[model samples]
Target: MKRPFFVVIVTVLLFIFACNQSVKVEVVTESSMRDSTQLVFWKNLGDLYGKAFRGTVVAGGDGDTTFAGELVMHVRLVEEGVIKVPFIVGRDSSRTWIFTLESDGLMLNHDHRHPDGTESESNMYGGKTTNFGTAECQVFPVDQATVNILPTRTTNVWWVELVPGSHFTYNLRRVNTDRFFSVRFDLTQEIETPGVPWGW
Candidate 1:
């Protein structure tokens, strides 16, 4: 049987990525039949790994602010086993989120850097996944450091939801608080990649 178009594309891209590596490459994908839900999620995510996703704010925070401007994300597998995705706002490019594999599960870190390549004081605060998320969804709850960053909030849950070939959403909420935000991107569309995010 023939492979799906997505499978073909992913395979080719991985091959290209593999060829350029001088070190022992860390492989994340397995045979299609044996791919786990997380692996599938990674694969689907990897498809747009180097592409730019532009989204519109469907929901905003505190009386409708911030996350209300143009939203763009450039997802890329930046290392042998790490993925760094940058969230670019209209003109400010100081935020990027990084993900890496841990012994337990995936760890998400907030990388808020200044325009001068310096780290922000309140940067790198995110959580790890405690459960095996499906291919379509995975949620990350705020960890200890995250709580310390914003003491008043009791909860900070960040989730990514993807409906293959249709839509992808990045959502965040603080339980029982006015901090709710959701941005949805059209998977069917591709935008030009923005400039390198602040601090590389």
Candidate 2:
């Protein structure tokens, strides 16, 4: 009888914990602060328009050795709440990161290009902010186009973070699979910009 009672108590505790988690998930603080925060942040990058930043992979794993080389982010265009930043990886200048203003959130799109200015076989996939994330950080779950392009990446997510006067980070994670990649850029120092990216 005591053994049965112990099992019942364990089950009740688990149910209560699950309920609390569910409530927390359903209720996240959605405030207007995110807009003001992102706006200020966007202006900060816009202030650096046309300037290219050079940094290194800093850290990553899982077949991402190619990404461990010198990294580049060219803030090529900024206009009317839209910023077009390209990430030139090592000798590969085929990736452009598009960030646009959404009424409700920010949008992140990976613009992959070829040497001839043509779109890659797998390109134009990313995500948009889904919540009122803090100004210093925001998360974007994989978009539908991304999942459709690479079904295996259905669980992928990407985010960019900026800590004023410190560092900027580009991160990717394949949730539920333990695959992760992160590249940190030193914001304190700006390096020389590379030549125009291919097809730019």
Candidate 3:
């Protein structure tokens, strides 16, 4: 009876150990699958560091003259988990698109500043990715911060598209409206880096 009991105990322990190992493997695989697309997108954008590209308004700038002038985007600053691209529209260098990697996914913020390095009222208003987007594109719907700052823009959804060695595009659309904006940058040709953006 004692021998049988010992055998049963050993069998149960081995089963429990196998179950735990299986669970751990499953968890790791699930996490990798979830973040694979985001990781690829992050790396693709990061590869553009230190390069500057000239852009043109491809769509929906008729109502807003803010993008009328020459458009240039400098992939100026890239850190471990952050990438800053300053968007220069004509002589204005007050806007920077900041991309940050978060635990869940990615976040985008528009850092607007005055010439004197003062933060504008609408600074840091952007959104986070809600899903695992494709490796070439990630969409960010307006977050609560944006709604609080600009109530009318609560339905805005912004996305960035990248094609390595080809082109990159920034786009925005309102959920139920006709509002749309797109700017495409030529990645094939590298331009001279622009000056420092306002408020860095």
Candidate 4:
């Protein structure tokens, strides 16, 4: 039996539409999954707001004595899409790690300042996440601004790891070089919140 041409056309159109809808759904689901992971990561980090933890340099500080003093990280500020953590070494309170949420992914910026609340020359150098990292960790490679500030550090990559109620770590690596640093903080212990970071 020969089907009507109009009926055949209608069936073909419906099939095409269904396939298109399926594809669209798949794309949306994949994107939503990625976003969910990132949000979980952000929330895990934000959970530490207003808390301070003691840290120790666990790797790659052979020649650098800057971390020899008592190290502390105060997750002092948390705002919509932003987190500010001040890294204190002994009496120095000039460095803060700033995390900002962007459309694509998270951004990590190093905020350095003088004792008198003035910005340092090497401030605001960091990068953004290049992929959908897990809820426990995200990596940021050197960004354009960082390259402009420190041309020789074009290969720098930094990653932050957070394990709820366990530990938080800040790490750095100069890709292909021997330069690397890692500081791990115990999240189980909360310390006295330090003073506001310089140039806050």
Q: Which candidate is the best by lDDT?
A: 4
> Candidate 1 vs candidate 2: which has greater TM-score?
2
Question: Is candidate 1 or 3 superior in TM-score?
Answer: 3
Show model 3 residue runs off by greater than 4 Å: 1-29
The candidate maximizing TM-score is 4
Task: At residue 46, give the lDDT of candidate 2.
Answer: 72
- Candidate 3 residue lDDT tens string, 109-200: 99999999999977899999998888889999999989998999999999999988999999999999999999999999999888888887
Task: For model 1, name the residue pairs that clash.
Answer: 49-75
lDDT of 1 by residue, 28-88 (tens): 6434322575666666777777888888787765466556578888885567557788888
Clashing pairs for predicted structure model 3, backbone only: none
What is the TM-score (0 to 1) of candidate 3? Answer: 0.83
Report the CA-based lDDT of candidate 1 relative to the real structure: 0.78
Our model 1 lands, by Cα RMSD against the true structure, at 15.9
Cα RMSD (Å) between model 3 and the true structure? 6.9
Q: After superposition, how far is residue 23 of candidate 4 from its true place, in Å?
A: 15
> For candidate 2, lDDT tens digit of each residue in 33-152?
764576666767677787776666654655656775678787888999688888887788898888887778888888888898899988878988787566677788988878888999
- Candidate 1 Cα outliers beyond 4 Å, as residue runs: 1-35
Candidate 4 overall lDDT versus native: 0.92
TM-score of each: 0.76, 0.78, 0.83, 0.85
Q: How many backbone overlaps does candidate 4 show? A: 0
lDDT of 4 by residue, 1-200 (tens): 99999999999999999888834334556568666778898998888889999999999888788887999999999999899999999999999999998878999999999999999988899999998789889999999999998999999999999999999999999999999999999999998999878888
Ranking by lDDT: 4, 3, 2, 1
Please give the lDDT score at residue 185 for candidate 1.
88
